[model samples]
Target: MMPLIADLRNPAMRDRHWKQLMEEVNKQFDPHADSFTLELVLDLGLEHHQEAIAALSQAAAKELSIEEALSKIENLWETLPLDLAEYKGDYLKLRSVDDVYSALEDNAVALSTMKASRYAVAFLSTLDTWERALSHISETVEMLMNVQRKWMYLESIFVGSEDIRKQLPTESSIFDAVNAAYCKTMRELQDAGTAYKGTMAEGVLDGLNTMDEKLDKIQKSLDEYLETKRQAFPRFYFLSNDDLLEILGQARDPLAVQPHVRKCFEGIKSLEMKEVGKEGRKVHEAVGLNTPDKEQVPLASSVICAGAVEAWLLGIENAMCTTMAQLLFKCYADMKKTKRERWIKEWAGQLSLCSGQVAWTVECTKALHAMSEGQKTAMRQARKKQTTLLTKLCDMVRGNLGALDRKKVVNILTVEVHSRDTLDRMVKANCASVNDFEWLLQLRFYWEAGTDRCLVRQTNTT
Candidate 1:
C-alpha cells in the first residue's frame, strides 16, 4: 500500500475545532462522563452524516430524509424483484426495459469512482465501522488468488473457437435446420396425439401419427450424430508447436529454470591465451547460469500460465489420454474455491430456467389448441407475466440507486410488503449490474424454446 497525502491521526492541526463541537453536543444532552468518548464520536459521525447529505442534492438522495435513512427504508415491497415466485410475463418486460438502462448507467458511475464509498470528516471524532480489519491474512490470500485468476482468464483468450469446435461437428450450418425440424415434428406429433387421442390412423388423423413417429426418429438420429462429432474432436488447433514457446508459454510437466542473484568474479585473462579458454568456461557459469542457489518462482504468476496450459491440454488429452487423467479435472481444481461455489449457484439458477421453459412450452401448445376467447386470454397472460415482472423489477431497482443508503434499502427489503412473493426477493437482491439482472431473467427463459431451461433441467434430474 502507498502512503496517503495526510496522516489520519494528526491531531494538532484540527484539535481545537473537534473539542468545540463535542462541547456543543454535550450541552444539548446531559452527557455522561466516562462515555464522553462515545458521545464525542457520535458528534463526529453526525457531522459526517450532515456533510454528506448537504453535499448531495435532494434529487440525488432520491427524496430520502435523514430520519428515513436512519430508521426506515423506502420500498415498493419487501419482495425482491427477481425472487418473486411468480409473475405475469408481459408485465415484467413492460416494467423492466427502462430500469435496465438506468441501472447500467449507475454501474458505470461505480466503476469510475476514484474514492471508496465511505468518507471521513475533518472534525470526525467517530467510530469507523470498517469491516475486514481483523482478517488481513485472509484478504491478502484473496488478493493473491484474484491476481492469479485474472492472468489465467487472459491466457484463456488465447484459446480460439476453432480449438473448441474440434470436439463439435465440423458443419455448424446443419445444426439450425436440424433443430427446427425436430421442434416442428415434435409439435405436429403432440398436436396430432391431442386431436386423435393416441397414434390412431383413420380419416383426418390417418397417417399423421405415422409421420410424427418417423420425424421423431429423424430427430433422434441427428442427436446421435451430434454425439459422434463430440467423440471425434481433435487434440489441438492449427497453431505451430513452438507457438507456446515463442509466447513464453509454460512447458508441460517440465522443470522450471530458477534465476539466482549471484556476484560474478571480476577478472581479466583474455590476452593470456593460456587461461582464455578456462576463463570463458568459468565466466559462463559465473553469469548466474546453472547456479547452485536458485529462488523458487512466485506461484501466483506461475499458476496462471499453468492454468492456461492445462485448459488447452485438456483439449489435447481428450484426443489422446491413455492414463485417463483428464486435464480439466486438475485445471478446475486450481480455480478459486468460490468459482466452484458459483457453479453450484448456477444450478439453482438453472432450475428456474427449466421450469420457465415447461410453462412456455405448455402455453404455446395451449395457444395452438385453444378454440375460444377465454382460454386464449389465460394462456397468453401466463406467457406474458414473467416478462412484465422482469421489466418492472429492472426499472424499480435502477430508480433506487443512490436514492437511499444501502443499509436502509436492505432493511426495507427485509420488511417491505410485496404484491407477490416471487418478486420480493428479486427486489431485495439489489441489481448490481444490468448483466446480473439480464442473467436472472435469462435463467428462466431460453430464447428459442420460449420455455424455461431451469424447469427442463429439473425434470431431467428427476
Candidate 2:
C-alpha cells in the first residue's frame, strides 16, 4: 500500500526500481534459485547493446574520411612559394660585368684631369655600386635555396600523409568516392612541386653562377688598378726634385712631362724646410738652377696642384674600398643570421602543425577503441546482474509456477526490467572515459611546450 519510493517513469531511475521489485519478488516466493534461466534473459539485452556499439564504431570511422584528410594536406601545400616567374624576373635584374666595365670606362674619362690619388678615389667609389649589385645577387640566391628546401620538405609531408589516407579502409561508398577525388588533387600538387624544383635549378641557380663569374672578373680588374696606383703615387712623394726636373726636361714622352714637373714641385713644397734644412737647400738649388726664368715657378705650382689632385684621389679611393668591404661583410653576416632565425621559426611552425594533425587522428582512433571496450565491459556487468536477479526470481516462483509459466514470467520480467533504448543511451554517454580525454590533453600540452623549447634553443644558438 506504500507509495513507490523510486520513479519508474524516469529513464535514469527505472533500472534501480526494476531491480528492487525483482528482489522483493524473490524474497516473497523463493530464496534459493539456480541462475541458468537468468543468464538466458540477460543475453537478449547484450545483443541490443552490441548493435549500438556497431553504429558508434561506424560513426567514428566516418569522422576520418578522405575529404578531411585532403583538406589538411592542401592547406600545407598552399603555404609554399612557387612563383617561378617572380624569381626569374628578379634574377634578370642583377647587373652584369659588361655593365660594370662600361661604368669604369666612363669614370676613367672623368678622372683623367685629376692626379693619381684623385683617380684612385674616384675609381674606388665606383666599385661601391658593383658591390651592392653583387650582394643583392648573393641574397637572392640564398632566399631561393631556402624556398626550395622548404618546398621539398612540405612536399614529402603531403606525399606521406596521402599514402596514409589511401591505406585507411573504405568504410562506405561515400569514402570511396571522396578518396578518388582526393587522389587526383594530390597528384596535381605533387606535379607542381616537382616543376618548382626544376624551375629553381634552371633559372635561379644558373643566374647566380653567371653573376659570380662576372663579379670575379670585375674584382680582378679593380685589384690591378689599385696596384698600379699604389706604385705610381709613391714616386711623386719620394722622387728628388732634380731627378723629376731632368725627366721633365728630357720629356721623350710629351704626355708624361707635365706629370713629372708636377711631381717635382710637389716634392719641393712638401719639404719640412725647418725640420731638414739640408733637403730644403737641395730642393731650393734644383728650382733655382733649373728656373732660368722666374715665370717657371708658377709652372711648378701647377705641378703641385696635380700632386694635390693625386693625393685627393687616393685618399677617397682607399676610404671607399674600406667602407665597401666592411659594408659587404656586414651584409653577409646579417643575411646569414636572418636566414637561420627564419628557418627555425618557419620549420618549427610547420612541424607543429604536421605533428598536431597526426596526433589528433591517433587520439581519435584510440578514443574509439576505448569507447568500444568500455561498452563491452558495461554490457558484461549488466548481464551478470540480470542473471543474479533471474536466479532469485526462479527460486521464488518454483512451487507456484509450472515450467512453461515460469519461462513466460521470466521473459515478461526481463522485458520490463531492461529498456533497450535506455541501455543504448547509457552506453553511448559513458563509453568515452574522462581519464582518456585528460591524458590526450596533457600530451598535446607537452608537444606544444617541447616545440617552443626547441625554437628557443635554436634561436639562442644562432
Candidate 3:
C-alpha cells in the first residue's frame, strides 16, 4: 500500500497507478474470499480517485460551454460590416462564468446589429404599445412584399424594351405613382419601426390594395402591347421575351442582334457585321457559307474591333444628344420667362376661387336672416334643401383648399423656384447639357428596371 501510494503521488503516472491500486483493494475485499482484519485499513485510495474524476468532469464541461459561447460570438461578429471592424479589438476572451457573461455584455451591439430587424421587433414586444406596433410592422411588411413581388413580375415587361419604354409613357407614369406610394409607405414603416409609432392600419392596407390593382392594370396593358409587337414581327416569337426585348431595345447596336440571328434564320450560324467607315454605319449582309457539299460566295468583307464600335456609337449618341439639347435649351429659355407669370396667375385664380366661396357663404347667411316670418315658413322648406347642397359644396371646397395648402404652390413656384433658379444661373448659367437630355431617354426606366440588371437576374432566378 505504501509503494502504491508513492506511485500515485507521481503526477505523470497518477491515473494508471490510481486505477491499479483501486483494482488491488477491490480484489482483496471480494465477498467469497473475505477475511476480517483485526485493525481496519479504511482504504481512502478509491475515494481520492472518484473525487478527482468528478472534479475533472465538471471543469471539462465548463470549458466546453465557454468554447461554445465563444464560437457563437465569433459567428455573430463576422456578420457585421467591415466598417465596424474596430469592434473586434473590444471582444473579451475570458473563460470563467462571470467572464462569459461580461463577454456577452460587451458584444451586445454586435448581437443586436447582426439581426437588426428581428431585434427591433423583439425589443418592441416588451413595450406597452407592442400590440399596435406589431400590427403596423406586420402590415408594412405585407405591403412592401406585395409591392416588390408585383413590381418584379410587371417590371419584366418594360425592363429591356426600348420600344415599350418610348411608346408607353403611361407605364412610366403608372410606375412613378406606384413608386411614390411605395416610398411613402417605406418612410412611414421606418418611422414606425424606430419610434414604435403607429399609422392607421386601414391606410397601409388600402395602399397595398391600390398598388396591387395598379400592377394588375400594368400587367394587362403590357401583355397586349407585347403580343401586338410579336404578331407584327413573327421572328420576335422565336426569341424569349427577354432576348427579344434586348434585340429590339438595342436596335442601333448591330452586334447585339448577332446572337439571335441563327434562331431567326435557319442554317445561319451568325450574321457577319462590318463597320463601313469611322461614322459607325454598320452594314450587315448574309454571306453564303463555304460548305464542303456546296459552292459559296462572299458579299462584304470589313472588320472592326468592339472598342472602335463602341466609340463610334458614343460619337453618334453625342451628336444626336447635342442637337436635342440645343432645341430643349431654347424652348426652356423661352418658357422660363413666361412660367413664373403663368404660375402666379394660376395660383392667384385658386385664391380667388377660395375667397368667392367665403363670400357666397356670407351671402347665403345674410339671405337666411333677412327672411320675414310669413316668408320664413316657405323659406324653411327651401333652406333645408339648400343646407344639404351647401354641406356637399363646403366639403368639396375644403378638400380643394387642403390639397392646395399641402402643395404650397405659391411658396414653391413664386418663392422657392425663382430664388433657386436665380442662384443656380448666378453660379452656372441656366443651360442644358447633353447629360441632361440623356436622362430623357432613360426616364422610362428611371425606377431602376433598365440599369439594374440584378432585378432581371432575380426574376430569372425566381
Candidate 4:
C-alpha cells in the first residue's frame, strides 16, 4: 500500500499532473453523490495531505459506497502514519462502521430471502431440518451461540486488543438478522400453511420459539459483553464461581446473586470453553429422551449473562414474556435498534450537517422521491433517531463493559440468592406430613442471592 502511494508521489505530478490525477479520481463516484468529489477532499484536506485523511474519513462517513472506500482509505492510512499500529487501532474503531454496513447487507439478504421463500433455498431449508433430529434444539443452538460468541470475542482479544486507550469497536450483528428472519419465517410458514404441509409434532413450535428466544437472548448478551470487554478482558465468560469470588476478594451474600435466584453454570472451565456442538446433542438424548419416538430437552445448560437487557430494562426480558407476540415485538424492537445503529454509524461522516450539531436531519429529496410519504417519513425518522439511539447504545455498551472489566480486575461479582427452603424443608413442611421424599416433580431449586461484583471461583453442587 505504501509502495503504491510512493510510486504515485512525484514532483512532476504535483503541478499539472495533480490536476489530471484529481479529475480521474473524482470521476469514480456517482454524479448524484454530493459527498464524493476530488475538489471536496482538497477543500477538507486544506492543502496538507494529512488533512486529506480527515477529509477522506469524513467523506467515508457519508458515502453509501462505504465498504469499498474504507478499504481504499485503509491502504491510504497505512502510508501516512508514524505509529502505524495505533493508526490501525483507530482504523479499527472506524471499522465498526463497516460492521453496521455489513449487517444492513445481511438483513437485506435475509429479508429478500424471506420474501422469496429462500429458507426453501436448499442450504437454509436443510439447516432447518437439521434443527430437528438433534436431540436438544435449545442446547444445540446454545452451543452454536457459544461457538459464534467465542469466535467474535477472540477477534476482539487477539486482532484488536492492542491498546486500551484506543477503543476498537467490535462488530455485533447476529440477532437482528436471526430475529428478523425468524419472525418472517414464522409468518411465511404459517400463511403458507397447507401450501407447504408438514405436521409439526406437539411442542415442536414451542421448542422452536424457545430456541429463537434463546438465540435472541444470546445476541443481546454478546453485544453487551463485547462492549464491556472493550474496557476489560471478557473474563466473565469463562470464570468459575470460586475464581469469581477470589477476584472480588469476598463472596457476595448468598442472598444477592442476580436477576435469577440462583446462578448454576454447568459449562466452562478456566478461560477455555469447548464447543458443545455434537456433544450437546448427546447430552440432550441422554438426559432428555424417554420414549421410542419422542425427543427430549436438556436438564442442564449454561445461563448466559443478560447484561444488555439488564442494563437497559434493569432486568431480564424473559420475565416480560406474557405472550409470544409481546416477545416478538421486543425482538423486533431490538432488531430495529441494531439495524438503525449500523446505518447511522456507517453514513454519519457523509451526511453534511450544520457543523456544531451532534445530530440534525438533511433531507435527501432525490433519495426519497421514489418512496411513498409514509415510507419516506419513516426512513427519514429512522435515520435521525438511529443516529441518536446508536450513540446511547454505544454508551450503554461501554458502561457495562467498563463495569465488567473493573469487576474482573477487582475480582468480585454480585449475584443474589433466593428465599425458598432447600432439600426437604419446603417438601415436608410446605407440602404435607406424608413425606418430602414422596414427590414426582420437585422442579424448583434455584433460590439464592443475586447481583454485584464477586470473584471468580470453583463450582459447587446445589
Please provide, for model 4 over 1-462, each residue's C-alpha lDDT reduced to its tens digit, 9 standing for 90 to 100: 343233233222223334434454553333235664557545443244444433433333333233333344334323321111122332211112233234334534533443344223323443334333222323333333443343333343334333311222232234334434444433433343321121133443454455456555554554454546323533344454333323222111211232111122222111111223465342111111111112122223222322222231111222222222232333333433555334222221111111101111112222133233334343344345444543554443445344323332122111100111221233233323212232213222221125211112112212
Ten contiguous residues minimizing lDDT sum, candidate 2 = 283-292
Would you list the rank order by lDDT, best first?
3, 2, 4, 1
**Residue pairs with clashing backbones, model 3:** none
Model 2, 144-257: lDDT tens per residue? 344334333322332334432232223222333422433333233245453223223334445434434433443344345334544655544445533433332332322333
lDDT of 1 by residue, 1-462 (tens): 011112212222233333443454443332234554545645545444444223332222232222232122112111112111111221111122233234333433432331232332321221121111112222322332332233223223222233322333332223334334433433443444321121121221223333344434433543454344333422222222233222223232212111101111111111110111354342111111121212111111111113233342343233223211222222223322433223222222222223334444344334334413335344334335645644543444455443223332333233222222333333344322323442234323222324211232222232
For residue 124, model 1's alpha carbon misses the true position, in angstroms, by 99
| Model 3 residue 242 lDDT score | 66
TM-score of each: 0.18, 0.18, 0.32, 0.14
Supply the TM-score for candidate 3. Answer: 0.32
lDDT of 3 by residue, 178-282 (tens): 866755665554444321232343477678778988988887776676677666656567778667666656665667866765666444445444445445554
Model 2 / residue 216 / CA error / Å? 2.3
Model 1 poorest 10 in a row by lDDT? 264-273
User: How does model 4 score by TM-score?
Assistant: 0.14
* Candidate topping lDDT: 3
